[model samples]
Target: MNLNELRDRAYKTACDHGFHDEELSNEHCLCLVISELMEAVEADRKGRFAKVPVDKKDTIFDERTFHYQNKYFAENFEAYIKDCVEDELADAAIRLLDLCGLRKIDIEDFTEEMLYGAEESCNDETFTESVYAISTIPIRYEYEYDYPLGGQLNSMLLAIFGLAKHLDIDLIWHINQKMRYNDLRENKHGKKY
Candidate 1:
């Protein structure tokens, strides 16, 4: 329910998946998960489990997305960005818990009162240089021992995968299933959502 509990669930899931290596970074694992998700998205498009597109990279930190997220919208956007990131993070957390034999209800119990915050500082004249911030600092520091944003993202992702495991769905597997749904399939205008 807390960060430490979440971390324990995540670490155990990683170990169960055979991710053994002291030097292996959380960044590395997060990258792997994102890569897997992207690949799964592509594979679904092809109607089979294939490789991910070489070009689809992490746009979360992309220059343009960051530019907009930090610019004039800094004040108003902080909440939106935080919400989006949290959804992704929470989904990741749920997935990880699922993998660890935990149920969705269990995760809901933890999330009930999670305190999340968002702040921003911008300086770029052209883009309104701003820092779009969203965090649960207490939870982040308690689990990772560092304030790095990547840790928060990874912890959330681990939980997500764990949740997926419980539902007998790999991240990619679920994406593929979504692709089959008319509401989710790309309709030439881009993804349905």
Candidate 2:
């Protein structure tokens, strides 16, 4: 499936998991996405990959659980560490997609623009300009004018895409895996960090 299709699926999955039932504001959604990005950074620093922890039984299944070490290593340690980064990045994209779906944004267009912008940013010598260029996306007030997070969603997506490219990760595949894992969670991955 394409990115847009994935966005729709992620949103639907989140809804099925009760993300929309809680009346979350745009700020809450943005904060959740930011939290996921922070988790990605933490995962990269600590080398914890895969959702299952070494001491699975002891985990509280809350936001703090991402720091736990994984005992279920089926491959090289380096690959596992990379996978942790991939998974966290995927979570970031998934949360952004969920927000786009909730707010009825044209993420396909936004994604296309982001891709072009990213390609352009690749040639630039400075990182700050690239960041500024990617973070700027026009906001529409059609569907939910009162929501503030809608404006920042594109920036989040651009950041995730940039991070994924830097890490040499296939975001779509990781997103699919994360979504599947989310589906099987006890409460739609609600207990997960």
Candidate 3:
């Protein structure tokens, strides 16, 4: 998945949906990313994951849109596939990518750099610990003096991709589904923030 393209799409979608109506502080953007990571941690603790049953995998994508709009699907399949650990990770990635797009960072390069080494580096850290570490990486952009925010964000993206790999998540698929869902939602997703 070309990350820069996804970044562009994510940011554009956010702007179109009114998230960009006013200037957003970097802290606020990273806070949203951290929020998604926190949700992932909760999903892990609760044993939630986006595991499409083997029998359903073949047809899930074919009927993706139908299920996305269905109340039953929203309650059941949504819990299984949309509010799971992997999906939350995808949300975290999308949030970061949107930030990168807003700042015009070249995330595709960072994504390519991290692709092969992802599953190899995070073996020593538990999933929750690693996620916590990733969450911390983005905050440095707000407080540290003279550190390039793009580079710090790229580092966080590396950690996020590593977690995604360790979990065997098809993040691109989840991100696509999420982008569609985001497009259909109310402004600021009905949140005051």
Candidate 4:
């Protein structure tokens, strides 16, 4: 699915699981996304990434292999996807997508080239620095009344995609998996959010 469709799907999953019982401000939503990014940083520092067995890596996310036991509960489970870098990045992106859906931020006109440009335009900063950049994007929203929140979110998303690309993470797959995982979770995904 394209970003818009993913946004819808993410938001729907969140709503079904009770994340939208009350409206949240732009700041609150952006903070949640930032929180996920911080989690990604923590995961990275600890050397936890989303690796499957070398043999099954390519097909690990396939429908038949998408079970939690295979993805996160297997023998080497802790060494892989549970709150790993890739998973947390997916969570960050999912949180951003969820916000887009809630705010009705229609990014249908945002082309792949636009995303490419956003990524290319970024400074060659460290991953943590890039996360810092993303964190700063939304803060400007509060002070810049004329600027659209969608623009900030789009920039934030590009940084996310860029980091995923740099780290060679199959972010889309993780997002799909996390969304499914979230679906099976309790209200508000068992969090107070």
Best by TM-score: 3
Query: TM per model?
Result: 0.28, 0.63, 0.85, 0.83
- lDDT of model 2 at position 155: 53
Instruction: Give the residue spans of candidate 4 off by over 4 A.
Output: 53-60, 67-79, 108-112, 118-123, 141-146
What's the CA error at residue 72 for candidate 4, in Å? 8.6
lDDT of 3: 0.79
Residue 190 accuracy (lDDT) in model 2? 56
Could you tell which candidate, 1 or 4, scores higher by lDDT? 4
Ranking by TM-score: 3, 4, 2, 1
Model 4, 139-190: lDDT tens digits are: 6654665557888888788778877766667777778777767766788866
Across 12-58, the per-residue lDDT of candidate 3 in tens digits comes to: 99998889899998889999999999999998999998766434445
lDDT of 1 by residue, 118-169 (tens): 1111112111111011123225465669644444554444334443333233
RMSD of 3: 3.0
Off by over 4 Å in 1: 1-7, 47-147, 150-193
Residues 1-193 of candidate 2 have per-residue lDDT tens digits of: 3667877998988888777767777667766766666676676667655543434354432223332242322232224433476787787789889888888876545455675565545564343343333333323332435434555575557656765565455666567657766664455455532
lDDT of 1 at 122: 15
The per-prediction tally of clashing pairs is 24, 1, 0, 0
Relative to the true structure, candidate 3 reaches a TM of 0.85
